[model samples]
Target: MKPKILDRAIVGASLLGILISTYALNVEMAIQAKPEYKAFCDIAEYLSCSKVLSSEFAKGFGLLPNESALKIPNCIYGIIFYCLCIFLSSFDKLNVIRALFGLALCTIPMCLYLAYLLAFVLHDFCVVCVSTYIINGVLTFLIYKKMKVLSAKKTC
Candidate 1:
């Protein structure tokens, strides 16, 4: 695929990631304000987004200590990540594309850990969480493709 096309695809995926992460953040805040609130993504007992979002793991990626100062919600991190991706995708420099590809690649381990938590610990399916994971995967692939195309042009 062409680098320009791949960059556009990356932007598209980042936009989707932002939208879903924003929705998840809103849901998280709503749940905090009203404990009894029901999110639209809370489909069923086994597939409850609220259940997963409300868990302790949902905050700080469940990787930080309780007393840590950076205990922001995971959704916030997702929003920041997607936004950064959008910014990086706008650049045509090879180094910028490499950085973007590396950034997207780094999210995989976090996604795997969260997916494991959702399945084993939380025992619930979160629509927002799964959607973000898919978006990240897509973004990574698109960025990698773009990086390869750019590298090939320089080589030729």
Candidate 2:
């Protein structure tokens, strides 16, 4: 695909990620404020976004303890990541594109671990979580395409 097209796709995917993450953050806050609150994505017991979001693994990227200084909501991390991606996508430098590609690629392992938790530990499906994963995948692919296009340009 063309570099311009890939850039647009990356920006679009990153924007979507931002929106989803923001919504997830809002929902999380609402749930915290009122435990009885029902989110729009709370469809059923097993297929509930709230259930998954409220899970212990949803915080700190499931990597840090609640008391850890680095621990924060996963949605916040998503927001930061997508914003960085959008910022990085504005550059045409090969190194910048490579960095963006690397950043997007790094999300895959987190996605896999979250998927495992959703399926095995949490036993719940989160629409918002899954949507973010898909957005990450899209961003990764688009960034990769952009990297290849930039690399080709540099070689020529």
Score residue 112 of candidate 1 by CA lDDT.
94
Task: Report the lDDT tens digits of candidate 2 across residue range 1-156.
Answer: 887788788888888999999999998899899988899999888889888887788799788977898788899999999999989999999998898888888999999999999999988889999999999988888888889889999999
**1-156, model 1: which lDDT tens digit per residue?**
877788778888888898999999999999999999999998999999998888999899988999998998998999999999989988888999899889989999999999999999989889899999999888888888889888998889
The 0-to-1 C-alpha lDDT of every candidate, in the order given, reads 0.90, 0.89
For candidate 2, the TM-score is 0.97
Task: Give the least accurate 10-residue stretch of model 1, judged by summed lDDT.
Answer: 2-11
RMSD to the true structure for each prediction, in A, is 0.8, 0.9
Off by over 4 Å in 1: none
Cand. 1 TM to true fold: 0.97
Clashes of 2: 0
